[model samples]
Target: MKKLFTSYLDTFKGLSKEIWWLALITLVNRAGAMVIPFLSLYLRDDLGFSLSSVGWVMTCFGFGSLFGSWLGGILSDKLGYYKTILLSLIATGIGFLGLQFITSFWAVCLGFFALITVADMSRPAFFVALSAYSKPENKTRSLTLIRLAINLGFSAGPALGGIIIASIGYYGLFLADGITCILAGFLLIQTLNPKKAKEVDQEQLVENPLAPHKDGLYVIFLIALALFGVVFVQYFSTVPVYYKEVRLLTESQIGLLLGMNGLMIFVFEMPLIAYMERRGWNLIGNVIGGLLLTGLSFLFFYIEGWPGVLVLGMATATLGEMVAFPFGNAFALRRAKLGRQGAYMGLYSMSFSLAHIFGHNSGMQLVNSLGYNLTWAIMGLITLLALALLFYVKRRANTLKI
Candidate 1:
């Protein structure tokens, strides 16, 4: 264990100050990630929306993201990551503010799409900024650190959000979430001055313009990863409704359960990644193992009567996330062509958002028609197919003479 600790230390050896600040920014922004976790609940319990309506609203968020992710990449490449991040954050906060007033089905759905589109547009740009701020050897570790911060913040978001809802009500939740997002944006403005950020962007690779759409193998990889995302998103879309409606868990109890995922990732992700790297484990193998575990974790939901079993399942899924996400990010970063960092990463981010669209829509429909158990079972099966395809793609990815 001590040796593993040392390996974890090794991963952070040469990170720049900028990288640390970026992580801080991520933590601050994600800590306010209170809205999405309880969105289905809010719509269902508060506004009396059906599960199908909740799913459709969530899908709108994803659809907006599809556009936002691509546009964010372009802006990051043009305006620099600093500006793109700043603007997206502020816009997203405004979007949430809009959500505070709108309750009609079309109004809420449209607001959410606009909000997601603006907010998510920063993702690719943020990826580019993160990559630029780290040493080449520390790429995966850097991404993991950023993810660690995200989860750490997420750990707090749901629990705190639950308390907020109990104390101040649902609109208060929207207000608080909006404020923090905009705060993160302004913080970027204060820290990443134009002169400093411009110099940094000048040193980075130029845009590849056509790489994301044109690269055949990378496109195949995106499709596969997106499929995996379709399965992954059910954690937010369908799982909470299941817990509340089927298992009769309270909001606080539900918060604890979801928070468990973030907490596990916060505490264990880096060390696990460090251990795997030191052991000289193959990344493709790690990804495949993660994917299988993800499938099995969802499959564990088949154990209907035991809450402990569900906890175990969430724990297992976090382990899968730790394995797959960093390696996949590192893989994408490595694949970016000269000058196309923003475009490629944006495309990658877009693929995941696209998955949210499919996942929410389909998962909700399955819930209505097939019952909860079969819904989860089908999701697990989808992951199995994705896992197989990902393995084949990993082999192909390895052979590509990039």
Candidate 2:
């Protein structure tokens, strides 16, 4: 245990202050995501929203993010990463506070939209900062650490939210979450300021580095990644509804399940990425496998009555996420051409937004019309298609030498 602890510390030793600061920002921002883990329940139970209504609310949030991501990237390039990040944090914090005052469905939806927009806007800036910070050799590990921190925050956030929501309810959760965002923004303000790194010898060897690629590769990757976003969006939209409406789980139980996924991510993601890197597996293969694992895990919903099955499913899917996401990010960052890091990251962020808009709206419709079981089953099938797409993408990347 001590050895492992020391090794983990060693990983951070040479990491840039920018990576640490951004990651710390991620930690604080994600802590507020606890409110989101059970947002469907809050909408349905506390706000008296229907599934369709919840879908629209999520759609608004997604729509906001679509623009937010692009704007963040553009602004990062023009206004600087530090300014963009700080502005986004302020917007997101204000939005979270607005959530406390929502009484009607429209108000809630709008508030969510505003909050997600700001949070998402912060993403491109942070991504650009991270890419600018690390050496190619340590890049993957650095991202893994960032992810671990985010997951660690995620694990604790929902657990804390669960306890708070169970006792004081959603109002308290929203207020506390907002305050946390404010604190994060303040910390980031103190620590991070972007200063460009001079090109090193190793940077020259890497072809078409984040210098800005015009080959349209970024667009293609963005499209494929949006499909991934579609699959992931189910976590907030369909999964919560399923746990509640179909399986009859309580809020606390749902929180536990969501937190369990984060726990697995925190525990296993970095080591797994390291192991795969050691084996010389292509980054694309890890992404494909991750998508497959995530898709297949949905099959466990067939055993939802057992409760533990859901826990096991989270663990399985989380393992896939651990493997796929970090590698995919590293690959994408490395492939981005010079000076286009913000644009590429913005496109990447947009994929998640597109997915949320498409996935939630469609999943909610399917659930209302077809039923939760069938909806999940169909979603699994869609994920398989995404995996197949990843396969094609991998082959294409190899051919293009991207």
Taking all chains together, each candidate's TM-score versus the true structure is: 0.94, 0.92
Q: Which lDDT tens digits does candidate 2 get at residues 128-148? A: 777666777878888888998
The global C-alpha lDDT for each of the candidates, from Candidate 1 onward, is: 0.84, 0.78
What would you estimate as the lDDT of candidate 2? 0.78
lDDT of 1 by residue, 110-221 (tens): 9889989998889998898888777776778888899988998888999998988888898888888788898888878777665554322224454434566787777877
Off by over 4 Å in 1: 1-10, 196-210
